[model samples]
Target: MDYDVIIAGGGPVGLMLAHELGLHGVSVAVLERLTEVDETIKAGAINVPTAEALDRRGLTPALKAAEERNRAEYLKFVRERFGESAGPPPPPVKFAGHFAGIWLLGDRVDENDPDLTARGSASLVSGVRQQDIEVLLEERVTALGGKILRGVEVTGIESHADGVTVRAGEHAYRCGWLVGCDGGRSLVRREAGFDFPGTPPEITGHQAIVEMEGHEQLSPGWNRTGTGVYVHGPIPGRILTVEYDGPPVDRDTPITAEELQASLRNVSGADVKVTGVRSATRFTDNARQATTYRLGRVLLAGDAAHVHSPFGGQGLNLGIGDAVNLGWKLAAVAQGRAGEALLDTYTAERHPIGAWVLDWTRAQVLLMRPEPRALAMRGIVSDLIDTVTGTTYFVKRISGVWQRYDLPGDHSLVGTIVPGLEFADGSRPADHLHDGRGVLFDLGAAPETGGRVRRVTAACPDRPDLGGLLVRPDGVVAWATDASGGESPERALDTWFPPDRR
Candidate 1:
């Protein structure tokens, strides 16, 4: 076999998966037809959940630096709630302010508060450009001994029981599995016979990276007009503009300078001269997702599995998530340390979420439109809606923290997902993944009975309730019980990760 795993696209998602697999010492290779260049594509937008995923993987320092302004892209998250002296409000109200629980709080009201920086998930999310993120990922993957072959395209793919075969540059390589992170037009997905079904992006949007000298009217936190949405002030001077209506854009073709200039003129109402064209891409809000994330030995992730509107800036964020979700599972399966059943969870957990992304982005295509009718309706809703809780709930859901596979019914407290915690490992005490070992977190200091479960003292004061949690390598809690270890934790553990040879 040429490699254990071959990622067809070298975009953010592909690079992230490669990096994740590299962490587990997995033999992986990434094949890309496009020669990576220094261009700012995805205007830095790291949502809360994505930042958390990076943090859990111990990549917080690198990702945090990439978050340029360190703040969310919304006003305030509003919900339908009745105050002590008022009646029930409508859906969440979004304003140009920093308020959690609501989704649409993009602009910075104040930059002094650390929490307002949107630095972390469960707290806030900062923005990061796609180009910078890709650069970081490429470095990490290469550092981890993973092979990245740029300008190499896959002309053909053939699958067999033993392994899958990929033909790239007159060479036939075999691998236990083939993954398609190849973007919307995935050659691997096509070769694997996985169908990509959904709506194509309808609205035109463009993003470019530039070191802002200064902008006069971009203040008052986040600024918006009927032509487009201009988000500003996470960083003192940096700004991001979303143009819904502009010149026709073709993804397969190189974006043109004229198209960008025209879009800026029509949307921003001013011809803003950019210092440097770091990177530019023209794509509409498309709502398409792969029917199945997995087909036999082939699996799909990121843009390969799902493609949607970037209004939520979830395209890159969600793609990174797919990598984290599947990386450990792939590593375990390849090392024979996991059962085949473990592989099925990848699709089971991610496919539904992918579908949800398409649905939500499709909605944004309408919700965020700058049309007079849409604007008037939003304004009315904003006024009628006094409570911001509903909107906050919706935004939080879209933020991806609401995505939980191991639900309450799926397992007990120990079987749920445990937030990253600090623990001591005997002689050498340190903080690592709450997962990785797939051991159920026995926070109760479950006595040293001869068993497969590893009990550790939960040093995190915030999650005292999760002290006796049993965690899986994929970071899902398998079981949660009292300090007295009896049958429930053991049963959940047996079902999750069983010890045979030991």
Candidate 2:
């Protein structure tokens, strides 16, 4: 085999999976159609879990820099549009996320809430662009000795019992496994025959950066017009408009300035004339998911596995989450460190998460419609989201701070992002999790941890009752304990990382 795993698409998700596999010393290849990364910001929000995932790998510095730049840009945009205020420019819009254009306020989140406190929710949401995320992941992948063959368009895929063959251009390469990360209309998914079933779109949405003479006519902030919703500002000339028109026949057709202007007028009911267009794209609420994330030796991740509306800014985050969940599992199987059955858990754990995201977007699409019932429902949701409890719930959901898998464990902490436990040395559990290995965080000096699972001593300041935790490479709690009185932690370790397999 030319590589242990071959990843199609060199976008953020593909690069992230490559980085994870590379960290485990797995031979991997990434094939991307684009010669270089696109600088335009596609999805602009990085949720909490994604930030933590990057932080564990020492990539938080880059993410922070991008966050700062994004914040500064937003501030500048606001000041330019509204003029500098005397009272310190209104604290950067505390409520950064929304559902169906209805804003969810961060200020409404009760810091003292018991559940929120236990989750160890940090200042995790950011407005960094997808391009920045790709750059950071690409850098890490290359540094870790992974090959990313850009400008190589994947043409065909053939899977055999022993391995899979990927055909790109004039070359055909063999790998033990193949992964599709190549976006919604994925070639690998189609050719490999993965059944993607979901709802078709009822509306078309357009986001563009354009230069217009009459841009001032369209007000900033969310506007629920008689036709559809149009949100402007947070940046100059940045327009996001939704039309109730049916899904377009050709999503791949390049968006022209005139077409965008017409759609803008139709949705906004304003004759905003476009002078020049910078960049634009079209999207829909057409949600879909592969029946199974894997088919024999071929697998799927990111957009290749599922597709949903960008309503909650979940597309990029969901894709990265897939990479995080699949990377270590796939690497373990490829390296013979674990059985093929381990790969089955990836689908079992992630399919529900993907389904939830698809449904989440579907709900938002329903709320955005002009129907009287939807409008009434939108009003009710708007009120609920303005309160402390409701805002916290949405924030937790959108930020992915509440993500939990259904692992076999009795502890409430199991299958959640391990609480950010701090140590006496001022280092946290995340500090030791960088190597992409499962951790037996022995808070009570547990004796069973040694070879396969790395052991660490940390103070569980928040939950002193918990003696230890078995953390997966993705920073998820596989098993956790309230005390070392039992052998459950050790048993959990054996179940997940059997020494016999190694």
Candidate 3:
């Protein structure tokens, strides 16, 4: 095989996957049709779980810098909108995400607070543009000696029983596996004949950065108009407007400044004139997911596997999750260290998450419908969200503090994020995960274990009950043991990374 894995599309998902594969010494190539990584400000909020994923790989410093830039921009906007007259900026906003058009309080959702957790300190959500994430991933991929071939479009794919062949024009690269990380309308997905089925779009959406003269009059929050919903935000001149009267957009047509202005007016019922357009794009509420993430030797990730409205900024987060989850499992298989059965777990674990996100976006679309019933529903949701219980639930769900995988084992912490444990050495267990190796963290009694696992001894004052934990490369707790070793740490290691014949 020319490479162990050939990834189509060098977006954030593909680049991050390349880095993950590279961490495991897998020979991988990324084919990107674009001459350069897109710099468009796509999704910006990297939820907590994803931040933890990046943190595990020693990407926290850069991630934190990116997030700080976003926070600065947010503070600037708040200052321009409300000066000292507002009295200390009203303590910044808390629990400030929204359901439908109803805004939640902001303090509860602040990602910068490391000590902000239901039980203890949790990882902060990183607020960086998706394009910036791709750039960072690309740098890491190159640093790890992975090859990313830009301006190369995937033209053909042929899957054999043992390996797969991908053709970009006349050049054919053979690899043990082919993964489509391309966007929605992915050629790889179409060529692989994966089944994509979901609900059609109910409304067309517009996002753009433009010079809108006197645009400050547009209220800086979610607005439900008679026609649809429009969100003016913490970022000035950035607009998100939805129009209910819509046949799905012809994505082939470029979105112009004039077109975006019309959308702004229709949705906001305001004469928002766009003097110039920096960049504009169109999307829809059409939610779809591939029936199966893998088809034989060819697999799918990111937008290729699922497409939904850009509601609540879930698409990018979901795609990144797929990359991390699939990366380690695929690398193990490619290195002939694990059975093909290992790959099946990728779909099993991620499909439910994808399905849930699709439904979540659909729910937001339902609430945003331009009708009295929709308005009433939004009020109901807002009321529910105002309660302490509702506030905690949304904070967890929106911030991804509640994400848990159903890995094997009966322990409560099993399949859940093994809460970030700080040790006596002032280092985190995640610091050892940078190499993409499963971790056997011994909190008290050290385990006698071996094979594709990194063993560490630490004192976790936060989680004293966690005597030992077998953490997957993806950071999911595969197994845990109390001081008595309820679940043998050795058995858990053998189950995931067995010391067996290749």
lDDT of each: 0.62, 0.84, 0.82
**TM-score preference between candidates 1 and 2, better one:** 2
In terms of lDDT, which candidate is stronger, 1 or 2?
2
Candidate 2, residues 1-502, lDDT tens digits: the string is 9999999999989999999999999999999999999755379877778877887887777777888888877776677566777122445333247888887765788767554565432335467789988988888899999999999999999999999999998899999999999989999999999999999888888988888877767777888888998888777678888888798888888889998888888888787898888878898888999989999999999999999888888998898889999999999899998889988988998999999999999999899898899999999999999998888888778777678898888888888887766666777777887989988888874557657798887776666687888899998988877765444676677667877565
Tell me each candidate's TM-score. 0.78, 0.96, 0.94
Clashes of each: 47, 0, 12
In candidate 3, what residue range of length 10 has the lowest lDDT sum? 113-122
| Candidate 1, residue 191: lDDT | 77
**Segments of candidate 3 deviating more than 4 angstroms:** 79-96, 106-122
Error of 3 at 50 (Å): 0.6
lDDT of 2: 0.84
Residue-wise lDDT of candidate 3 within 1-502, one digit each (tens)? 9999999999989998999999999999999999997755589777777888888888888887887887777776666666634432454243346667666776445454432343222265456789778878999999998999999999999999999999999999999999999899899999999999999887888887778876767888788888887877566567888888864548778778888888888877787789988877789988999989998999999999999999888999899999999999999889888888889989998999999999988999999897888878888888888776676677667667677777768888888766777777887777878899998888886567854577788888766766888889988888887865676666567667866447
